[model samples]
Target: MDDLYDFQESFSYKLVKSETTSVIPSSVRKFQINFNFSFELDVSEWILSEDDESQLVSQSHHPVVDCLVSMSSAQFSSFEESQKYMEEKLTTTSSGLSRLKSSNRRELVDYALREAGKYTAGGGAHRVLNLHFDVLLEHEYIYLRDISNYDESTRHMVPAEDSSIDHALKTVEYSLDIPEMNCSVCLESLSGDDYYREELLSMPCAHIFHGDCIKKWLRTSHYCPLCRFEIPID
Candidate 1:
């Protein structure tokens, strides 16, 4: 029993509505449905979980906390101002906290989004890198960290510009025998009647792909999808 708590723990609280006596009528009382957040940190391995997702926001030079503290809407002043600035904002925005309901994880997330919108509207939005998701699946919980800002994309796009465009064009025009080789991207042969007339592209490394397919691929990738000859981002 003692060892089990080292890894996991659970709690239960009975939200009382009103005191009932043996002579008085009693109504079933339950806890209000409201979303709140909790977190843990290593004080080490700080960069492990954050290294990849940080780029999702397109920030280059600053640490995660640095970006959040800079947000004018977020009332955070320093790392130490945890409760006063954040709690005050959340409580003030909660106009109908007693009515909110979250019976499951998805409903909980929806409640959170509504609360966040209320908080942001009330001018108490704060930027921080510490908040993340706690997803429950199959009676287990998984932790996932995320940025507080809702506007940023969580996916990466292809780098802009291409250094070997001229060489690539020549490779497609002079070397391709469309009927004999498949476009490496869609994995469909140019010989098919469906693509007999569609434009094709080639990389300097000699890989071929449908013109439209390669165009979209290049937006998110700078290398030949097959050979990985790096296309320059200029």
Candidate 2:
């Protein structure tokens, strides 16, 4: 399994009700909920088997610690105002949280942006956390693919053609006119003094090799051994 994405965010305040009052008191219950939190979110990508239809992926994280803050309600004009203020903080990055380093921090930032772009994305109840929390928030977001898919990008996944490959080999063979030069594969000089002169071949990348060495390599792969340039197997 590969950790492909990390998603984490924190909300600053909670809405609590008093049992003594039939109706919860309005006004932001602002007892100075001034606390900053640092956290990590990691999601892994896995394909259980080649035969499997749906991928089994897991995202995991530790629960946020209870480092509560107390604020005076007088500081808030209204409950709605406090809620709005906390929501605004969601858009801004805190200096403390951004200073830390993580391998997946970039993926975390990308995930957050994609979620914000969605009209349906929000924090609510969902599954797959593997543990229960007092408040559970589920966010549905898409991972924007950054790389081209292998199926669409290259038709060379199949076998190479005999005529095309033979042409490439002949071009390279004709260019290397030196009577004595080293074969890159076997590290031996190809000379008029040695046999197997007819067994030499050249890739489209112009690297010279013994026909045997390259043919064996090309049997499994369709790329130039030296430069990793894709061979047009067509």
Candidate 3:
């Protein structure tokens, strides 16, 4: 009986050792990680999961142990790298958008004019002109008379200058003199009754004005009549 008991104890000890020896160390166990990525306009997220089942079970015995052991150093490093890359990309994209907005003022004006034009077509000539005028005025507080001079025939003529900046400044001045039509630029009424007649000119950005005004403007600068957006003259 003593010998039998000794043999049983020896067998149990050997079995335990064998089991322990078969298990790979936590560091040696090959683990595969899968990353799930989510893409959005404002933010992004990632989920990490293990790919191997046998390795995962071998790493921990209890359910709680499984959770603790599942996380690997390599996986952590990968996640951190991915997060940094995403942050940098987002910052670059935001900066690009801001620059685009600042540099594309003329483009914005042109787009607005094109959209407004669609509604002006087939409308009364006066109505069409008024619509265009209103659209321009909405964006810029300019006087109506600077761009539209009245002739002896009471016909409206465009200014002869191509400089949109000058036109804007003149409009502001005119607005100031007229009290009844209190111009915001001048904060006064337009006092002049004199009117001139001339043909209007159109810029590549789709802004329209008197030919002379645009020409003179172009001599000094090349930009939209309403916005100081850069134009490629060459």
Best by lDDT: 2
Query: Which is better, 1 or 3, measured by TM-score?
Result: 1
Better of 1 and 2 by TM-score: 1
The most accurate candidate by TM-score is 1
The digit string of per-residue lDDT tens for model 3 on 40-80 reads 11111111123211111001011100000122224333544
Query: What lDDT would each prediction earn against the true structure?
Result: 0.36, 0.38, 0.28
Q: Which is the winner by TM-score between candidate 2 and candidate 3?
A: 2
Candidate 2 accuracy as TM-score: 0.28
What are the root-mean-square deviations of the candidates from the true structure over C-alphas?
A: 22.3, 22.4, 37.7
lDDT of 2: 0.38
User: Model 2: per-residue lDDT, tens digit, 1-234?
Assistant: 112243343322222211112232365332222323333223232222323332333333323322222223342335445444434443223212222233233333333333222311332222111111122222222222323332333322234465556655642443345443544333344443444454677777767776766676565446564455565565
Please give the ranking of all candidate structures by lDDT, highest first, separated by commas.
2, 1, 3
